[model samples]
Each structure stands twice: as structure tokens, then as C-alpha cells.
Target: MTIHEIDKLTGQFYECICFKPEHYPKYDQLQELFYGDGKLINGNYDQPLEFTVQSYIQAIMHQIDDGNATFYSQQEISDVTEVFGKTAQRISVYEYSFTAENTAPWKRGVNYIQFILVSGEWKIVSMLWNDEKEELAIPEAYLV
Candidate 1:
């Protein structure tokens, strides 16, 4: 598939996580689109933890119990590069803004995501990201 197509899928995957407040996470969608064994790293996590998309969405659901549900307003992909081989890799930089009611102001972050083509479709294999911080910020070129 083309980078453009993969970028669209990435954005949709995030939308599934942040925008579907009216229902339980569309975990089945994630299960098919992501590697059954995926890994995620974020600010709260101490290490890159491996998980099935089902478990990952379950974790997100737990956050909702605390009245936290972030919805994204914008999503941008940059620095896309593809390496076609036995396991094709599509890597890119992702940026987005999200906010939840009664939470801090809208926060933005730059992240690195890597996808591999499995069973003829792109599946996120691993990802790690941090909210924009004083020491490390999204580069100006990627701010678009």
C-alpha cells in the first residue's frame, strides 16, 4: 500500500481510540488492523509494554472510569519512509492534539510509529511517544 493510505489508517486508528466515547472501544477493529502482539510506550509507562490490541483498548477503557476521555482535534503525519523487504516497514512521525473535559488545556505530542505489512495490510507493530516538553519539542518542520 502507499504511504498515503497508511497515513490515513494511522489517523483512523487514533480516532478509534479517542473519538469513540459512545461505545466500548472498537477493539475488534484494532485486533485486525494491528499486530496481535503490539507494543506501546508512553509517558506513564515505565517501559515499552507488549499487549494485544484487545488488552490495550481495555486499558484505555479503565481510564474512562476516572472521567478521562481524550478526543483528538488534529492529526498529522510526517517524515514517512518505507523500506520494502521480507517484512516491509513504514515508519513516520505523528503529531496530534487531544483534550478531555475538566482536564488541562489541549496538549500536543510528537510520536514515532512503525507499521509492518502483515497479511497484505498495514499493522502497527510498535509505537512510543511523549507529550511536547520543554527539552524535546516537535520540530518546526513537523508542526504542520
Candidate 2:
């Protein structure tokens, strides 16, 4: 049951960020999945960019408003999750596209997500992710 709930929460995490041109992104829903003071980190560059939950939402909104990400969708291709007591973690392999109907993703990446059981509910406490670059390809094992 714990794993199931975690999976559902992760699914919701992805759902909140995806949107088509005609639809608004569900970025606000992210507040429900994150704990107080939850953070997200983007480690794709030389220096990691860290954000509080609200800041993360604002950043994505800015991207959309700037027309940089007018249409976007992201989904998990694979994940490995481990649970111990009230704390759990997941290494999720994901694929994303900027096009509305792309059969293949334009990019792939990995996310390290940390969770804690709070009041019998699983909530994301932190997440760090890095996109796959030309020199830093995702390993075959992670893809499977």
C-alpha cells in the first residue's frame, strides 16, 4: 500500500506540469503533493539551481509565459523506489517533449525524489534532477 501511494503521488507530480496549448498547466496542484518547505533542484548546469515549492511554480509559469514551453509533457519511463520505515526515495527515469503529439520525447532525464510519511500520507520533501546530456547519457540499466 505504501508503494502504491507513492506511485500515485509521483504520477500526480508529473501530471501537474503537463499541458497542451489549449489547456492551462496544473502547476498549482503541486502544492498538494509537497510538504511544507519542500524543495526542487535542477542540476543540469554547472551550478545547481534550488527552489522552494512556490518558487518552482513561478519559474515554470515564467517559462510558459515567455513562450519557451508553450506545449510540454513529461512522464516517467521507469523508476526504482525504496522504502524504510517512514522515509522513502525514488530514482525516476523520465522523458519529456515540447511538442503536443510527439511519439518520442525530445529529452530524457533522471529525478531523485525523497519522500516522508507525514500524518499517514506520503509527501515529497525534496527532488533533484539532471537532464541527459550528450556526454552524460543515461545508463542502459536505468532505461530498462
Candidate 3:
């Protein structure tokens, strides 16, 4: 019903994935932010990788288990949200790094997230994101 709720949920989305070297990610918290049929997609590569909420958590756990991501941090830099009745969408710009000590983010990306009001609470329906690359830099407008 309010943008503040949306903002808070988005903030939680970022928080649930971040972790320090001595701590594990709070991925379990994600289950509470999404609808039962929610989906997440990573479009960084040629072929988009899609996952259900549970699968997304498993994938991240696997990354940690493989030691590919011991410490990771991701935060939204900017976002634009639009609401219409019970549906809303947010295009968020984010920066992230695999190491917690990095002075600058190693990568930047955009996430297009869709939300719907279910039983008076907003829930994420789907989220799709792509990382910035050499030929595909983030637009200056989004950086602000």
C-alpha cells in the first residue's frame, strides 16, 4: 500500500544475500519476501539461468560451499518504482563484490523486480537481473 513497504522489502532482499567471512548468508529470509511461485533469473551470460525461490537459495549455498564466494556484499545504488493498484515494479541498480574489503564494487547490474499484493502484503513475483560487461556498461542515468 505504501512505497516504504516496497523499499523495506527490497532492502531485505539485498541484506539476505550478504555475509561476512565468519558468517553465513541469511538466505532463509528470502522465503518470507516472495510468493510461493516466485522466480529469480540471472541473465549475466548468453543463456539466462532461472530458478525457483528454493533453487535460488540452493545455488547461492553451493557457491559458498565451493568456496567461490566466501564473503559477498550486494547493495542497491538506485531504483525507480512504479505502482498500479495491487501490482508494482522496480528497476534497481546495484553494486556488488565477492570480497567484503573491496573499496569499490567489482560489478554493477540492474534488477527488474515485479511485485504483487497478496492478502494485503506485497510479495515478489519475479526478479530478473543482468551484470554490466565490457560492451554493456551501466547507463549514467541509472548510476544516479
Candidate 4:
């Protein structure tokens, strides 16, 4: 597939799954777009727990519910690169702005998502992300 089509699909990735929490029920469908069980690695573990799709979904929902958070997200797909012919990746600098009824705003982050061309369609294979912190900011190249 052309990189342009893949780019649009990447936008859909952010729109369908990341930005809209109401669509969380259909998250498994999103997961289905991935190759394996897949993972969303948020750097909270000492040994990098590979979160299966189900685990990630459950954790995300639980966090929102337990924290009483109203979650919102928007991503700017800053760059896309083809790893190999059928393997591609994109780095998105996103505004994951959310707020809890009793807490401060949620931190923004950058995500690196890899997609594999399975059958005829592109599917996400792995996703890794990290929140921008005071000590460690997003790199300049990732910016628009």
C-alpha cells in the first residue's frame, strides 16, 4: 500500500481508538487490527510488562473509572517510516489531555506505533509510549 493510505489509517488509529473513550467497547476491534495480542507499554514497570490487548484495555478503563477521569486525546502524526517493505512505523506527538474530578490534568505523551501489512490491510503490531515529564521532554525532531 502507498504511504499516503497508511498515513490516513494512522490517523484513524488515533481517532478511532485513542481520542474517543466512548469507543472503548469496540477496543477489541481495534486490537483485532493488530497482528498478535499486542501490547501498550507505559513505562511503569521495572521489567516492562508486555500488556496483552485485553490487559491494556482493562487497565485503561479501570484507571479512568477509579480515578474519575474524563479522558481526551489528540495526536499529530509527526512522521512515518517504512521499516521494511511491509512493515511501517509512525511517531505521534499527542496531547493526552484529561482531567479527574479531583486531580490535575493528565500528562501528554509521544507514541511509537508499528504496523504490519497482514493480508491486504495494515495492522498494528506493537505500540510503545511514554509521557513527557519535567526531567525528560519530547525530542525536537518529534515536534512539528
Candidate 3 lDDT by residue in tens digits, 1-144? 469999999999999989987988897788999988589999987799999989988888898889887988889989989999999999999989876675754688999999999999999999999989989988887766
TM-score, per-candidate, Cα-based: 0.70, 0.94, 0.93, 0.76
Q: Candidate 4 — what's its lDDT? A: 0.68
- Which pairs clash inside model 2? none
A best-first ranking of the candidates according to their TM-score comes to 2, 3, 4, 1
lDDT of each: 0.61, 0.91, 0.89, 0.68
- Indicate whether candidate 3 or candidate 4 has the larger TM-score: 3
Candidate 4, residues 1-144: lDDT per residue as tens digits? 468767777676676555334544346466666688876787644666668787877876776677554455555636746657888887877765553233535466787888888887887788888778888798888876
In model 1, which runs have C-alpha deviations exceeding 4 angstroms? Answer: 43-51, 70-74, 77-79, 86-105
Off by over 4 Å in 4: 18-28, 44-49, 64-67, 100-107
> For candidate 4, what is the TM-score?
0.76
Q: Model 3, 15: alpha-carbon shift in Å?
A: 0.3
lDDT, candidate 1, equals 0.61
Kindly list the per-residue Cα lDDT of model 1 for residues 1-144, writing each as its tens digit: 467667777777766665544555455677666675687666534565655566777777777666676454445555555656524443345544444444644456755667777666777777666667667766777644
Best-fitting candidate, scored by lDDT: 2
